[model samples]
Target chain A: MPGIDECLLEAMKLPGARGAAVVDWTSGLALGTAGESQSGDHEATAAETAELARIAAEYQSFAPADGSDWSDDDTPVEDLIVSSRDSYHVLQFVRTTFDSSVFLYLWLGRTEGNLALARIRLREMARQLVLG
Target chain B: MLHRLAAEKATGSLMRERGTLYLSDGQVIHAESPDTPGLDVLLTAGGALSPEQWGEALTEAGPQQLVGRFLVDRGHFPEGALELCHLGALYDAAFFVLGRGGGPARFRYGVAHWMGAVRPVPVDAVQRETSRRREMLNEIWPEDDTDTQPLVQTGLGLDTGLPRRQRAVAELVDGVRTAADISRALGRPAFHTLVDVRRLAAAGIVTAARRPPRAANAPTRLPETSAAPDVSLLRRIKNALEAL
Candidate 1:
């Protein structure tokens, strides 16, 4: 299985990859970051992206007629993607029996990305990533 | 007839000119309106599915059985989650109705939505939690417009003796930050961050910024990310009377 750096290196191999980072969505902490900063404030953008993931989740869990349970702990999240005119922002959530709180964020160019292949590659990366 | 149809526990696309609202048992389970960002945005944002997964789900389902199961199925979201999404979809559609949000839309009723083997959350509890959030916000600002406006924190500076968490918030007082960003910085849960922000906002500790004027004629773009507190967010927190 590829480690964190290898996971990002693999993502950079995508057609229009711009930047990549492994972020803890819960903490807005970037374990590792590569590429030019989207807004010059990597920490701020990471926090904002993490917030987006969270609000969307809370909104879903609170819909009317909902019958599921949300344990009094952090829910496991999978992946998140935010598409804009120039780039695709991706967040992939990872879980290990020992720990399950890290995620990977990949930003790719809209034109350069082949949506299907990028998805497939990202899925593969998630399965193999090893975190410290 | 549709209301009656819903009462009968029917399933189908309940399309409206504005958008289509879906249901399984008089209670809404899934919704889609072309004039809005649609379910993909909400689902992707919520971390339930990746953009690629959502696309695949759309292609695989072919719009009828697929969207329904994608939402209702156990693996995708809990029933509470679907309901919340359904509401968001409706809100998005309602916001875009008569606007340029485009779609050839129609609602079909009486067909089984067949969301695959999903579990349900207690609706009442979720509603209560949301209401609690709303009330908390109201106590802080008591206004809806503040929600849409840019969030900026203009203060003197963080006091030295404050607790780490409050200090963290004080650090963010310079520029406007979102609840999500604050959550990430403090390493706290989103809800907890929201609660504190509201408390701070209510105590007159935080002031809401005015909304930006809408741009017209130009290709619309999302707002630029705001700046962070850099020794500038704090001003008078150190010496002002408790009343101020």
Candidate 2:
């Protein structure tokens, strides 16, 4: 039942978690953000991550083989993880009652963060994100 | 006027012909427009909240200007849901309000929306997103008339391979409904529906119902009983709602 701010605060507690945000991919708007962003600005980070989310969600090639035709329902891609030299970016998609176009982003340092655990927890958070 | 208000950290509503933008401490808290779907429509139309519940919420919490908090606290819906819808509705209306020059923008101080503030967006962010949306629509199809004029589905629609979302919008084009009408029917944001409409127009699946140009001596304003929304009256209604 955690709202956006509470959710982001929870995300920051993860080991080596630098920052987190909830973003609407369609509009490239960040609904909420917490902690420090390596990109210096949270808005800029939102737009960049939205681009990645849009690519994974929009393209047919990114969908699974046996999945139903991509319509307005939840996208087949569950989560996206990008590894840079020193950090990890994880985006977990949330299925809203109205529109399933939002995702939670977590920025983690490569050394202290557990990618597997972070991914699992993010999925849980996304599920707990009540839409209506 | 909007930028100046932001600079001065003013809190109130900015009234324009297209809509109203509510800013809290110089940041946008909410927006509403007659031509765009509101949060109530998005909620009830999307089936996320029943009309009865919305009515009850209004009766119980609207007077206190805590409908948003009340709904969340009552467990009728989550805060994120309300906030997200509010954000979408704001941007949808702000698109029409921004970058237009037909009428003047009047600012009133110390006023707040009854829906309450969920998030405060900077004026620059709102402006940036507005322009970005305009560019996106232009990139898909560079025409403004399709946004306001009645839309018609061409015979080419049956054969056109359109995406599912766009298909739904195209199917609603009866040569009578405008983009705003289609948007409210679909329970989606007007801007998103406009994107689909513009794409449909570009793909030849839909077109704006064309009309003959008026004579040079014709008045710029439409005749009485026009379909166009009444901005002044709408603004008064908005003010009355806030007062109540």
Candidate 3:
């Protein structure tokens, strides 16, 4: 599996891929971060974004109208996208048997980044991530 | 034992059945689980990166060094904020990792991290707080399987005595909107909304199904914990479990 450094380097190769972080959403911690000249606080942004994702995911699971349909095991998150005029915030939770509660967070300049490509890169990075 | 390990300021990896979660100085930094979507999903879901980018990144270079270095070198997040984000992510991930049942969890010490510069402020308070909230969530919902399951509300009964947030959420869910959609619709900060959700679930205004613990699953024919306790709440819980 790819180590933290290798993953960040790979992410930067993406078009307009501004910044990336391996954030532990469970505790809102940034495991590793990369890229340059960020616009805001990377760690806080990561924590906040993770918070948003968790709330969004949990809310989706607990909404009232969903009582009759509680037969399944968990909810599927297609994505949690929060966009500003020039920036896009992403929080991806990577689930492996080793650590199920962590996520990898990425931030990009909306104008410079290719959203679709960035997502694919992050997914690939997650698959190769080894926690130790 | 886990708490004791943390108190020892251990530096090592905690292994779980599904995956592994890493911790430094009792602060969790890395976690991987098989049951839920990994970091890629969180990133893509937020629309920062697309599937194609993930694929290309993988093909062009390995995922390890590339993703890690990119996060630190890119963007302009302040130290305080970055620290906050890191702490939040750790706690959120821990909520799922440490709480998983039916598995053996082991912690091996003496692992040093070269990426300590990337580490943020400590997350002791935040983690403790999240754990408390998780307990409350469990008290109400009593199930770990709901993390990925589709949420359903049957337009059940309720009283006006509930908190406004709870009332609002209940009313909204009663309308058949998914919980995720409601969270987006509410547009409130996630932390506040989630606390309210926990309250609603614990109050029985919301429900999820799970097999009760042996303590709770005792048959009606079995002797009770106390035959005539003056407490009414205990009686109520006992009644509920008996019905199950």
Candidate 4:
């Protein structure tokens, strides 16, 4: 029920959360953003992180060994976690009804953020995001 | 031209040969083109909403210029799904509109689309993304023929382990679907379709089929999104998957 802004605001309430964005991995655009971005520019962060998301989503090597079939609109790989020295970057793939190319990106500080909680919360958020 | 309009804080539609840009207070609120699928197609055709649902929503809210709000209020999905698709469709069409510069255009002051304002983009951002997208496509494959011309599988063979999207693009190549056509078929952004086509071309998986010359005034047909579902195409895909 939470819209992009509301969802992002909710993300900001997470411990150690610094910034959040809903990004399209295909075109590298930030559809919506909240909090403070790592690079001080949400668009730049979106474009740069999209490369990583695309790599993970599209590359065959990232597929599961079980070999379950997946369409382009649905990436089997759910979330990508990149940890830096000071913070954790979490990219959770959001499923839409059509062309699910978006992911929720959360930038969290290492000291205060609970990685497990963020992962669980983001998955639920991704699952519930309706606008297909 | 659009930049000047942006400076003037113009509100209306900038009509061009390729597409139209809907500006509100100098910001781009919407855009559409013959070369790209609109939000309705992106939503319904892409399987986010059924055609019936879309038809109903349009019938109810389109006249009020509140389809975006209607979709949001309906709460079928979660939130921000419309915005994501809206931005994608807007940028896809705006790319074509931006390309039509240096030509005569018909600008109407105080025009707006029925979808209402989902989100407005700055003139600078749209232009920046358009150029970047152009460069990105060129970087993949310089030729633009695969974009506008009918596509046929080269049958020279495709690389193993192609990405899922490119594989879907590969499946639809029967010498009739252009990149735009395939975008309509797949219900994704035209830019994504073109990007996939260019990559497939680079991999020798698909190629643009040449057509005979036509007279200058003979208009090239645009893909009709309102057409009934392509049962044959779906059948072919279903059969192919079964065979595999």
Candidate 5:
């Protein structure tokens, strides 16, 4: 498994990737960051993404209503993708035995980035990302 | 002091009453404290490894100073899992270890932690991270006194807005346990618990016990020592005046 910096570098290798960060949603702190942030300030961007992650993970409506009990798994939201006029942002949650409140944030150029590929790659990276 | 050590590229264990910080080539590789649960507890408490397996690995590789490597080589746990748990425990203990002020500290040259170095973080990076954690907590709740005080769940309506981890923490709060105690009981990182406790306080869902009165009554500042009269001379003059 790749460590935090390596994992971030791997994320940044995605086509048209502008920036990548591993953020702890609970504290709104960036554990690691690579490349240029969309907002220019990585800290502010981390906090902003954390707020969105918190909202998505906490709201009851986001919980899966399928017959299977959703409470068994801690993940309330799998991945969140935001598309803007010029860029795309992806947040992929990592499930762990401990509090699963961290997410990988990736920013990509709308024109050159493949949203589908980035999203798929992010999910895979989130699985193998070693936080230590 | 850590900067000086780092400058010299020191390799040793800095031991204090609160905990010990192990450094290799000036980088902090491991830390352990009684205030926070260690990697052993984190792994076994979560049922990732049985006690027997942990004991076997320790017994086999402890003398060789390859306990961590042995565990990983034996497939007891993935290297990533071990590193994560080790890092978590290291930082958790380091917070308290570094926070301890004016304590007797001793450094033993060439001493290394038994688990060995999983990932070495620069001394400056560790210090920056520690301060960042403090700032994060302050942002959530301005009061620093709540960090050590026993937690008391308030009757405020704010409890409903708590996140899942905070709710779990609130449920464990019995009005007697401090954040550190709750963290140990819940098998969570002490720093994470502190953050949640601060957030709970900020939300008015919980309150910390009032700080106790300090024993020292000394003034915050005093005049320059060179300008101040000698203490014995002043005492003698006062005694002479009283006798007169």
Candidate 6:
């Protein structure tokens, strides 16, 4: 599995990828970062994205209502995507045995970035991203 | 002191009252403390391994100085999970070790932790991460005393908006158990539990007893009792077994 730095480098290779970071949503800390941050401040972006991820993941409404058991194995939500006129921000949750509060944040330039490709690639990267 | 050791490319264990940090070529390879659960507790308490499994691994690899490799080779857990847990335990212990003020620290050259090295982090990185964690707590709630005191609910019904983790922490707050105690009870990392408790305090969802004043001229001698069994002899026994 690719570690945080390797995964982040792979993320930066995605088309129009401007910046990428592995953020622990629980602590709002950036585990790794590459390229220019969308918000100029990587720390601020990490904290903001964590807030968004926390809100989305904690709400019961985000999970499927089929009366299925709620567990870490069952991801409450997949990737969270936010788009502005000029850019796209993607937060892909990474599941771990201990906590699932980490995610990959990718900022892409809208004019050149492919949202669909970034989303798919980020999900794949999240699966392979190793934390140590 | 660590910076000087790192500069000299020193090897061995730095023993303090709160914990022990193993360094190899100036890099931190392992750490353990009584205040925080070690890697063994993290794995077992987190339900990653049974006590029997851990004991077996210890028996097989503790002497060989390859317990980390043994677990991975035996498919007990993935390399990633092992490293993550090891790192978590290391930092958690390091936090207390660093915070232990005025205590004498002893360093023995060429010593090693029985578990061996899963991953070695730079001395600087460990220090930086510890400071970052401290800053995070301060940013959330400026009061440091709340960390050591037993938690008490405000009884103001202020928990309606608490997150699941914080709520779980709140439920464990019996006005008796401190944050570290609750952390063990929940099988969560001490640092993470502190973060949650700080958040709860920041939100006025919970309150902590007033911190007592420290005595002037308190002796800096290392505490005689530790929270966990001493594993030094186990390492020696394992060494003998490996020699056989």
In order, what lDDT does every prediction score?
A: 0.51, 0.81, 0.52, 0.83, 0.76, 0.77
- Taking all chains together, the TM-score of candidate 4 against the true structure is 0.85
User: What does candidate 5's lDDT look like per residue over B1-244, in tens digits?
Assistant: 7898899999999988889899999999999887787777777765667889988978888877678888777877656556556666777788778874728778888987677777777887677667777777866666666688888877764455456677878887777898888877777778888888887776667788667567698577775668755654554465457546
Which stretches in model 2 have alpha-carbon errors above 4 Å? A36-39, A64-75, B158-161, B211-244
Q: Is candidate 1 or candidate 2 better by TM-score?
A: 2
- Candidate 2 pairs with clashing backbones: none
Q: Which ten residues in a row have the lowest lDDT in candidate 3 chain A?
A: A66-75
Candidate 1 local lDDT, residue B221: 81
Give the C-alpha miss distance for residue A73 in model 2, angstroms.
8.6
Score residue A116 of candidate 2 by CA lDDT: 95
Of models 5 and 6, which has the larger lDDT?
6
| Fnat for each predicted structure, in order | 0.00, 0.32, 0.00, 0.66, 0.17, 0.14
Q: Indicate the residue-level lDDT of A29 in model 5.
A: 61
Worst 10 residues of 4 chain B by lDDT: B231-240
Model 6, residue pairs in steric clash = B63-B238
CAPRI-style grade of the A/B interface in model 5: incorrect
Ranking by TM-score: 4, 2, 5, 6, 3, 1
lDDT of 4 by residue, B1-244 (tens): 7889899999999988888999999999999999998777888875668888788788999999888888778864444677777888998898888883526777899887888888899999999888878877876666678878999997766666888878888888899888888888888899988888988876657888985566899888986785676554554465457546
> lDDT, candidate 1, residue B53?
70
C-alpha lDDT of candidate 4 relative to the true structure: 0.83
Stretches > 4 Å off in candidate 1: A1-132, B1-21, B31-49, B67-133, B139-141, B156-197, B203-205, B211-243
Q: Residues A3-65, candidate 3: write the lDDT tens digits.
A: 565677777777777788775443354556788525466656556666776565455353445
TM-score of chain A of 2: 0.92
Clashing residue pair totals per candidate (backbone < 3 A): 32, 0, 136, 2, 0, 1
Which 10 residues in a row give candidate 5 chain B its minimum summed lDDT?
A: B231-240
Model 5 Cα lDDT, one tens digit per residue, A1-132: 466778889999999999999877765667678999978988789989998987787666675664212234435578999999999999998765443367899999999999999989988887676332
Chain A TM-score by candidate, in order: 0.77, 0.92, 0.76, 0.91, 0.90, 0.90
Residue-level lDDT tens digits of model 2 in B1-244: 7888999999998998988999999999888888888888888886788999999888898877788888889998887667767777888788888856637988999888888877678999888888888877776666677888998876764544454567778889998899999988988888878877886776667878975466989768864896877654564465457546
> Model 6, which residues run further than 4 Å from truth?
A1-6, A9-13, A32-52, A58-70, A84-87, A109-112, A129-132, B100-102, B213-244
Docking class of 3: incorrect
Candidate 6 lDDT by residue in tens digits, B1-244: 8999999999999989888889989999998777776677777775668889999999999998899989888878766556656766777788777763728889899998788887788888778667767877877776776688888887756555565677778899888988889877766678878888887776666778766777898888874797865454454465457546
Query: What is the two-chain DockQ of model 5?
Result: 0.22
- Models ranked on DockQ: 4, 2, 6, 5, 3, 1
Model 1: per-residue lDDT, tens digit, B1-244?
A: 4456545765565555555545555544543434334555545653555777766666767456556456345255443334333443433343323222335645465654433222222223223333434544454344343333334654634444343344455466445665545544443334444444554564455555765556777787875567854222242342245555
